[model samples]
Target: MTESRPHALFCFGTLLDPRVQTALFGRTVPTEAATLAGHATRPLAVAGDSVTAAGGRDVRPTLARKLGATVEGGVLRLSDRELAAADDHEIDDHVRRRVTLASGETAWAHLDARPLRAAARIVIVGDSIAYGRCDPEGGWAGQFATAHIAADEHAHRVFNLAVPGSTLADVGEQTPALLPPRHPDTIVVAAGINDSAVPLAASDTGIDGLRDITGPLDALLATARRHHARLVVLGPLWLDESCTGDFEGLRFTAARALELRAALRTWCAEHHVDHLDLWEPLRDRPELFVDGLHPGTEGHKELYRYLSAHHC
Candidate 1:
């Protein structure tokens, strides 16, 4: 309809999640309660742990025409870009249909012809390293996603939500809003160089003035637990003397990096989370580093190999 919310889309499934909207559309579109008549949602057992239903069950939904039935959901206003994003997000499993809502407005709705299963989802969040920085092919996470987590046809959908220069505290704040009501099968993180450098550069927390990552890490773990996501934290990267002095007025030390990594290892051990250690293997390989902080193209490629071998 060319009325309000010209590109209206009725969401009755995961698209209802604000985090999913942010990840897909880059922003949450305004939504209003709406209903679809003469159609009903039927649940199907989803292969793999892709879709999570209420009460911790698993289900993939199929919207089908059923006389006198109605599906209650919200209508979202999507721009051209957001409409394309939404279509891309559900490209593997859903098809869009122009349907009449209870409000007598014609809108788009996502439906599955077969509605058999959903691709298991993997969500990654972190800093510049995770963002792939200087790497042309995104990063290791991007590589892993492209290579496929499983060899079968039911490959998982991947999303890289990492932001550059993000610290543990910043990540902790963003995690809750990054995940959906139904958690992802896995959550990968790559960060920490920024955090360790922050305190030595500027800050007087009344303690030792050095950054303590344990507290923020714990908080992050707690948030992940609430979502029940399988966490995989990429370990610290080694920096050369280029970083030892000061890059952007922020002093980075090998000692602090080691300390933070050790804490992360210990935390992962106690919490039973996955920690991929790249420090030792990468420390001596100075050529792998780009700006002495982030990894280069080859470095990311090498990291992809490591990730695929270990945890992809």
Candidate 2:
């Protein structure tokens, strides 16, 4: 009798596809669906690509009224060769690494750490696009999570707490609560469009809505610094006034979008946070967008490539 392979594989990304699994692993090993606690899955935007965000805060709405949710996927147990193939396939956007399970056991999982520092805990906060709005498989966050793992084998972990329709103020208010008690190694802030759309009321004080967003971001950064974590702030992508979609008729203008990007860039510089500009690449590629804002699968792929080339 042939002996079974002694490896267990945990998949939380595109490999969850049964066909993808069969294609990679053959019919040699058994596979099952597994969920890890204290971790919720969601889509994340990396550079210009998409990936899953795992082993972080629960962004599902019901969990805490925040953008809390669980990203569902499949787990497989296969031979070393299968794992190697899987690693190669994910190499373009992710890196494989070891993760401790909720049960206190260890297993290999993919991490996306292109712009991430080694052994750093990074947090990404944003709105729908950041939360992966139109992505069918998930979104850029999920894509980044997978690619980060597959690309950088040494990053501690990437946490994503993006909420659909969430404004910068929302992120400022909610993200800190979701973060671990200790400071993170890094924090990526991707908010502005939503905040710009509504435009804070004139009477609002303390920190204008935009600054409200930046305030929390600043706080997170300070906390990260105290904990010795780096800070990365991502500016908004391009916006073509002529294009329209889900967010259409809402009120976002190209000028507004540009202004938002400028503000974010300035903020990052002022705070001394690493900033990544996602506008130039997508500016000419109208086809990349499913609507004016969301990215299609091809768009997501392009985003991954852009991020891999620039950040990773």
lDDT winner:
1
State how far residue 195 of model 2 sits from its true place (Å): 1.9
- Please give each candidate's TM-score: 0.57, 0.55
**lDDT of each prediction vs. the true structure?**
0.69, 0.60
Model 1 global lDDT (CA atoms, 0 to 1): 0.69
CA RMSD per model (angstroms): 15.9, 16.6
Per-residue lDDT tens digits of candidate 1, residues 126-241? 88888888988887867776765444435346788889888877787887787874346456667547777744434544434235666766777666555433456776888775
lDDT of 2 at 143: 81
Task: Point out the worst 10-residue segment of candidate 2 by lDDT.
Answer: 59-68
